[model samples]
Target: MSWKPLRVLTPRSILPALAVLLVLLAGAAAHANKPVPFGDRVAEPGGADASPVTAQSLDTAGLELKVGPGLEAYDPATGEHAWSYRREGATALYLAMAGEDAVVLWDDGLVTSVRPSDHEVRWHRAVPGLAEWLRGEGETGAAQRSETQRKQLAVERAAIALYTVPEASPWVAVVTPGLTMGFRDADGDLRYNDRPAGNCAYDPVRTVRTNYAVLVPRTCTGSGSNNHQAFGGITGYRLDSTNWQLATGPAVAMRALDGQRVQIEDGPVLGSRVFDTKAAAPESACGSRTEVFAAVRPQGTCAEPVANPGP
Candidate 1:
């Protein structure tokens, strides 16, 4: 049987196919070994007071932040240390992102903004009367030393709140149990101080931030009895100005919801009502029994409270 001459494979005909296969394989291998966007990890340094209250991936800035007793930044792609700030006696309570910088609120009532790129401090401000309060020297009246101690403990245990709207010029708000302070992110200058009206003393129970406003649920106590007769209400402070208007009256609890809305549980008579933080307009929830206090997102999906978990 005369078999046909064996066909000869030419290098020119097979080279192109081989090259294409190699290129495809190379691409797949590269993709498989590529670093994930937010998969970088870092361990807390030794002697940390508590676990990080906030861990954020600053993808645009190539940094990752972990805030607790101090603030630390790392390279998001490699988990390498970028910079850190630790005060001798201060503990960080809350953190917020202001444009490209990180705003940290210390337990000692100090607010600072730092650039994560080079660890440069943009600006720092100590809240008025906070140092004295921390030292237990701000108390007045004829209460015993133990009662002053109790008040000091309450002040130390008070919740801290931070708000920042990312923009070309961000707006930052720092809320404490005694005062609510706002700052312009561009210059870090004090913009507004929403102090208690008249003789009423402000005790911030909770705070939530929206794109346009900061909603604070405060217990305003009258001047008598060492300002112990307190009532609850919700106030919305505009981020752009010093104007703040009351949102709800006699609320026992307040919560932040989606769509820039806040849920206010009135003092039994009005039940719970949800309202827009920007416009102070109420949203009807009918008779639904959804627990508003349990639904409040104090950190707005970014940061979590370092202190009390429930209202």
Candidate 2:
């Protein structure tokens, strides 16, 4: 009997299939290790005071947020909750103090003022169909607007921009979804201030040094052109009383284009680069750089100069 020579599989085809299988397995393993957002992990904790008042308010003296179901409140330095209210149905969107009253707006659109010391419902109104409006079930949906009603409400509510004039002030400005501008007074009353056309973003990320009481919204629109220029300065709102407007003249602009990967040295980094194109123009150069942390593509060449110790 003649013995036939055994054949070995070629490395090319086998390696690709093995790589694909390994990639899928790696993806599955990574997915299993994903973390949940902080908000989802905890239940909304309700407050002790459950009063029913017509109109009330509280005085906030240096406080942080304490959340609960359809309710949120500010925990003052004295450990007493200043503002407490029930928003939506078991989902509290926001909690603010208007005088001694706790102003609450839930996901469902029910706005109510509750006595903080004694959880009393002072005044309550279902903004026509706010709950349905929020859930996207009503005819108006998310973008529904009642221009006359909005204007009237603004005047009646005494809404002010949420930000304070000085960085030292304890005042906070809040804007209702209906575009109502209001300020919470030192006594914590939700009084209508003035209305501005532009929208403002919350500084929850703490990216800016300004204590986010309220800020004038700054927007930069860029067509997807390679000609990206940096704004020369940082422009902020020049607050006049309860109102806020952008400071005139240009401000130092940071490049905000997406897909921007920047190189950082070993030490602290003050600014960032949005993309390789934007990286080309630097008003200030980074100090003598250290090594970068990146993996090269398999069988790919390094596009930029790399660090090499001289002999």
Candidate 3:
């Protein structure tokens, strides 16, 4: 499947556990989420002399720039380290280009936007992960956890999703259950902390992040109709600016067209779907609300229907 892991089906008994999980997140999330308070609290890299270059590139072939330990930038042609950024226990997870800057996501849930000119971390924030929420609570304490338990936590952690609006544009989004936040690419400011859009199910795996929007599966939680697989529709949350603005899209995304439009591709979708709770099914079925979908679009989706959002 294109999704990471945890597309699961559990007995209804798990609902109580899931409820507890959400409660735990509500408190712990607030405590663990710490972004750059004043933007400059985190020291910036000094001038060229402060760089970590072991040696200048002797080869003239012009090698590719690579990210190594601690998000270090190196020239593959000569093994020259141009610069490096590191956090004690954090490990670099992935790196993507945000215009001229490089945004790095760390395993510890920290997202940093760095300027390539020098080794300046333009802005950064720790987006809470599922692991953080469940870290050291009553039944989920670390000391008493088993290997299997840790693996399960890791799998859930992997489920935290992200979406960068407009491809390389600076605005980057991070999503975890019960919470969502957006970090601006220009100066590392985070302005969003709610659903990008819609009343879609809370299943993170069913959500797809695109360059400009996040498409989430539709559901009628307490209503009385079973979610029609294909017709459930989707609520797209676009990174319109300081926050996620609600928008609409097809049930499934087919492909991107020439400009701001995308080619619709899904089975016939009738009027809005009606979910029947009395149809009789495990609450766990909600976890698999929608089918698998590809990752975020490289070029993003249609342009935001709204204009420039404020800081």
Candidate 4:
């Protein structure tokens, strides 16, 4: 809900998407009802010509700093623009170092990598949704969200986090409203595999180590928002040594609640895990052979366990 200029720091080994993280408070629907503000990305007034950003660190390594609109570099020290990229609708988010190349990005998706010296395109890809879409019900909703999602997307706003570990793979955390949390490798491959549920937030518990655990929140189906409905258990996924290299696990039965406690029965789970095949089986046998994880309730009991495909 606050807007501050992104500061350029000396490249550190690890960086969280400091300027790119978003938090959703409880009781807040996942939609554009009470929209959170995406802060502006400009320097404070009267301090525009105060300092020059030279370099900064990202999830991978230290990247040189140059300011510009697209796949180009701007010299704050010299006030000169170098390098250029041609894209239909390019949203300049932040610049990071990808190996030895300067990577230009607007959000979780990569735009192109350029050389700092000449702004030459090393690698490039088309990233969709440079503009964040927040569709409201009608006129009123449109006006409320228009001031937030629209204006931010106009500037190509991005929510990014960077991190690194010793002897571990480098990773970048990205949060796009109404999208899933995405973790990208230095090579640009999505290390953290998650399908957008149209809504998501970055949680380090599952992402930092690639647990591949599928989180299944018990669904509560109720008529109102005050009923006491709960779920049988939680589900998750793990990497399998065989098969699709991923296996499902038994459900960790936990108490589930409706968002309003009244809509429990009608409130289905907003989280899920995808499976290659949709077949009914014992909860314990789920982790045996599957690329994805799912939940299976027992015959006599309402509670279920997370499933695995192949072990």
Q: What TM-score do all the candidates reach, one by one?
A: 0.58, 0.31, 0.49, 0.35
lDDT of predicted model 3: 0.49
Model 4 spans > 4 angstroms off = 1-67, 75-77, 107-110, 125-130, 133-140, 143-149, 153-157, 161-169, 177-186, 196-311
* Residue 170 miss distance in model 4 (angstroms): 3.7
For 220-260, candidate 1 gives per-residue lDDT tens digits of: 54643465555555667775554555634544676667647
> At residue 280, what lDDT does model 4 achieve?
17
Pairwise lDDT winner, candidates 1 and 4: 1
lDDT of each: 0.62, 0.38, 0.49, 0.34
lDDT of 4: 0.34
Q: In candidate 3, residue 282 scores what lDDT?
A: 12
List model 2 lDDT by residue over 1-311, tens digit each. Answer: 99978777799759999999999999999997776322222222344353322132334434444335534345655555454444323444445554444555544444554554545455543443344434434334334646545433322232222223223333344333333333333444445443322332222111121332233333233322375532212222222343323221222223222222222221133433211211222222332242132122112233555679789
Clashes per model (N, Cα, C within 3 A): 0, 53, 9, 40
- Candidate 2 accuracy as TM-score: 0.31
Which digits, one per residue and each the tens of the lDDT, describe model 3 over residues 1-311? 49688757677878999999999998798777755342322223331122321221122123233333245555664655555566555544456566666676655667777666666767768776533643323443577888667545543444345556654455776666556666778777766666422434344555655455554444333323364332244444544522222222334443434323334345464322212111111112112334123122223233435666789
State candidate 1's TM-score: 0.58
Q: Rank the candidates by TM-score, best first.
A: 1, 3, 4, 2
